[model samples]
Target: MKITFLTVGKTEDAYLKEGIEKYVKRLKHYTKLELVELNELKNTKALTPEQQKAKEAEMILKKITPLDHVVLMDEKGTEYSSTRFAAYINKREISSSATLIFIIGGPYGFDSSVYQRANDKISLSRMTFSHQMVRLFFVEQLYRAYTIMKGEPYHHE
Candidate 1:
């Protein structure tokens, strides 16, 4: 199965970009992975938080196809251990041929429309992290999950 890591805005920090790129390269050995960075909205001085989210939702929804399995990286979503997350990825790999899209919404979180389109929701942690930081963390965790799936030495209990 192909995996898509979709996020809003560019990751500006050099360190974060380097970290994300490292895992993305490693992930290529296991599965096809796509890293899509949507353009952030311009000139948002007038828009309220809700409005900004609504605009972001529109951009996000456009990237998804009907057959894609969309999962939102949300704070309120199910929390899983690394092993469990590995199992989850393995399950999806075994069960589906569709592209698995994992989305990290904009600052105010996902709008109702985006939420409605999601097939699942996963929480990286209860504590919040910066959106840019979440990109690197998610990719690293994904690499870890694959290693766990392969019974590699990269992950430990």
Candidate 2:
């Protein structure tokens, strides 16, 4: 199964982009992986938080397919150890579904509709992080998860 990370807006930082690209390359060796950027809302400053989430939710939902197992990367999501995460992906691969879509929502987070559309929610850490930084963190975690699945030394117990 393919893994797709759908994030709002673009990664503008050159350094962050470089790091994200590096992990993307590593993950490609283990799984079909890609990062998808949802267009940032226009006139975002004028929109209220709810309005922003609603607009962003619309774009996010439009990008998802019916077959995709939508997973949201949310702060309040269930936290997992590396091994556990590896097992989760292994289950999906063995289960033979379509792409596993993980979304990093907008700065204000998600709307009710986006939450309703999600099949699962995952947390990289209990601590909060910038939405842009989560891109690299998530990709690195994906690579690490695959390595653990392969019995590689990249992940430790």
Candidate 3:
């Protein structure tokens, strides 16, 4: 199965970019992984938070199809240990879907429509991090999950 990380906005920090790249490369060994970065919305000074989310939702929805299993990286979502996350991935792999799409929405968070469209939601931690930094953290966890699934030594208890 192919796992895709779809996020709104770019990773500007060079350090984060390098780290994300490293994990993405490592993930390639287990499955097809792709990171899709959408351009940030322009002229947001006038738009309200809900308006921003609605606009961002449109862009996010356009990228997803009914065939793709969509998972949102949400703050209120379920938190799992590293091994449990591997099991989550393994469960999806056994399903019929060809692609598993994970999304990280913009600063205002996801709209109602985006939340409605999601099949599941996952939380990285109780603490919040910048959206750019989440990219690095998520990818590294993804790499760890894959390694755990394969009984590789990259992950430890």
Candidate 4:
């Protein structure tokens, strides 16, 4: 099974890129992984929150194939421990009919349409985090999950 991370903006920090790359490489040991970036919508000076989401949502929807199992990286979604997260990924890989996708939306969060299309939602943490930082955290957690699943020493009980 393949896993894809679809995000709405560019990652400006090289530090974030470095951190994400480290874990992303590790994630490949478990499954094929890809990070798809959509161009951020421009000229948001006059747009309302909903309007911004609408424009961003259109671009997001276009990138998503019908067969993809969309999961949002949401703050208010279900939270899991490292072991449970490993199980979740394993479950999807075993049972999913298509690629599993996790999306991180823009500053205003995901649009209503994006929410409608998602099959599940996962929260990396209860505390709110910057979207750029979330990329690093998400990839690290994925690596940690694999370590847990493999009974490796990287993860501690």
Against the reference, the lDDT scores of all candidates come to: 0.95, 0.91, 0.94, 0.90
Indicate the TM-score of model 4: 0.96
Worst 10 residues of 4 by lDDT: 90-99
Number of colliding residue pairs in model 4 = 0
Per-residue lDDT value at 27 in model 3: 82
lDDT of 2: 0.91
Pairs with backbone N, CA or C atoms under 3 Å apart (clashes), candidate 1: none
Summarize candidate 2's per-residue lDDT along 21-130 as a digit string, tens digits. Answer: 99998887888987789888888888899999999999999989899999999989999988899899999999887899999999999999999999999999999999
List TM-score per model, in order: 0.98, 0.97, 0.98, 0.96
Q: Which 10-residue span in candidate 2 carries the lowest summed lDDT?
A: 38-47
Off by over 4 Å in 4: none
**Best first by lDDT, ranked:** 1, 3, 2, 4
Clash count for candidate 3 is 0
Q: After superposition, how far is residue 36 of candidate 1 from its true place, in Å?
A: 0.5
| Tens-place lDDT digits, model 3, residues 115-149 | 99999999999999999999999999999999998
Please give the lDDT score at residue 47 for candidate 3: 97
